[model samples]
Target: MFATSSPPPSGPWAGAARTEPQPRAPLRTDLLDTLMRLHREGVAARETRRLVPDAIEHRDLIRWEQRAARELRSMFDEVGWPGLDVVGEVGAEAAWWCVLLCDRLTAFQRDAHGLLQDAGERQAAPARHLAYLDDRLLMHHGEPQQFGTQHQLFADGCVEPYPVDNPALVAERRRSIGLPPTACRTAALRLLSLTRGPPLDDHR
Candidate 1:
């Protein structure tokens, strides 16, 4: 769910003409490595759950995830967003995955959004990542936006609480940053639900 290409300038800088590539901050290899490992374990834990919902490993996995998320927050506090250049491409992706999967939003939501926006402006991270951050922020604040990663859980199933703003423009937005169309993503989520069954909980 990450974009590879840089997005056009937006926000206060939207009207500025581009001339050169934005410079990136220094890399933090040590922190990047640690985050990468945590991200890998977290993805593994999630996959295990999807494969076997009642697995006894759930508690330990959840604990590991929580601990890793805390570590990530601490790292962010020290070094900001850990953009692709700072953490390397894979590490940045891992950081995004960790943020997305983390159960609590209080830890990194505010600073992460600002840092991600800065990173996006510098072209150190993909535009899609920034969009995802925006979506997460809007969702956390109970507002409506695009790229529907936010959902609510019920006894029967999960439901998207906000319809995308300006449904007609969604595909264009998605395509601008290399994301698949909204319909494709929705169909994929539907197939995943059918295969993996209802999620055990809403971790978002």
Candidate 2:
């Protein structure tokens, strides 16, 4: 099972306490709207899989996610990085989710994401998602320091692929980016696996 460095918070309200407030920034209405739409679709695709587990629905969701991913890649190509300045708060968050939902990310695209993540962190954009993506790419390449976001599935369930470097500081790293403790994230992933079932393959 997945485990984070911190102790799980107590009580039914524990989860709500972990929610990070979204940063507010001026929106470029058109771009923000586009990003928000993509975000909604991405979320809907996931929800569709959970609510109705039909193979056709799954394939359609995959295609939809892939299309969104490609569009995000194209956007990155035009603009070096979609930071808060370029996309505003909500737009930047949506852009990160679009990339995060991408099933297949190229080396070039991953590198671009890393750059965006770094820039976003520096600019005080919502960066927890970026960190998760960065750590995911690192794990995909068999490198270390994954921030505990990458996992492997087995007959039993999902497990973290590699030990996070400086385990003692995992919570600190997450906290620095306005993320909740690692325990919360790990628990959430476990809940997701239980509800949606493990990935068909170890794509994470």
Candidate 3:
């Protein structure tokens, strides 16, 4: 098991005995909001499945997955993993993968959402629900990164190149700029492509 690293406390609670657990920090508000949104989307996706609209209705699953992936990417740095500090320069490597995965998922969701929107009434909900739920599942199970592999970095039109001559300096500049790490993209993509398909049971 990864050893737990306790963050230093600056409040009066710091002196409290270990026997009495310190109150947990108020959850990161945005992270909580993202989770809530993801859950709401998941429910809608599930309801759609119950209606069993049609094969085309499966597109909803794609949309939800996409949203989850995007939201997760937005929160990747905030959700620091265990052992990251000791992982040395490679620490942020895993994060990059997740960003990639989320990006792919977002793309998938947009495509599916388009389909769902164009679809008939019976097809709409299921497609959205499926898309969202699948995304939630994928986000929950973010995969480990194979850092040495050929994954690429991305920044969806928000990132700009730095003018540094040194490669390392340039990379650091890129990181400081607006770019989703490689891991986020990889994880989101993996989840979406891996789970892309029709629902088994028709809600109808």
Give each model a TM-score.
0.65, 0.65, 0.30
Query: Could you tell which candidate, 1 or 3, scores higher by TM-score?
Result: 1
Cα miss at 167, model 1 (Å)? Answer: 1.2
Tell me how far the alpha carbon of residue 15 in candidate 3 is from the true structure, in angstroms, after superposition. 28
Clashes of each: 0, 0, 39
Tens digits of per-residue lDDT, candidate 2, 58-160, equal 5755665557766666766666566667776667767765665554444444756766766655763445556667775565555776466555433344444
What are the per-residue Cα lDDT tens digits for candidate 3 across 40-96? 554455343322323444466556556666555445434432111322212222222
Cα deviation of 188 in candidate 1 (Å)?
7.6
What lDDT would each prediction earn against the true structure?
A: 0.54, 0.54, 0.31
How do these models rank on TM-score, best leading?
Answer: 2, 1, 3
Cα shift from native, residue 175, model 3 (Å) = 43
For residues 71-189, could you state the per-residue lDDT of candidate 1 as single tens digits? 87788778878876788666676676566554344345555777777877887767766676676566555576686444333223343334567778877776766665543233223
CA-only RMSD, every prediction: 8.2, 6.6, 18.5
Worst 10 residues of 3 by lDDT: 1-10
Residue 10 error for model 3, in Å? 36
**TM-score of model 2 relative to the true fold?**
0.65
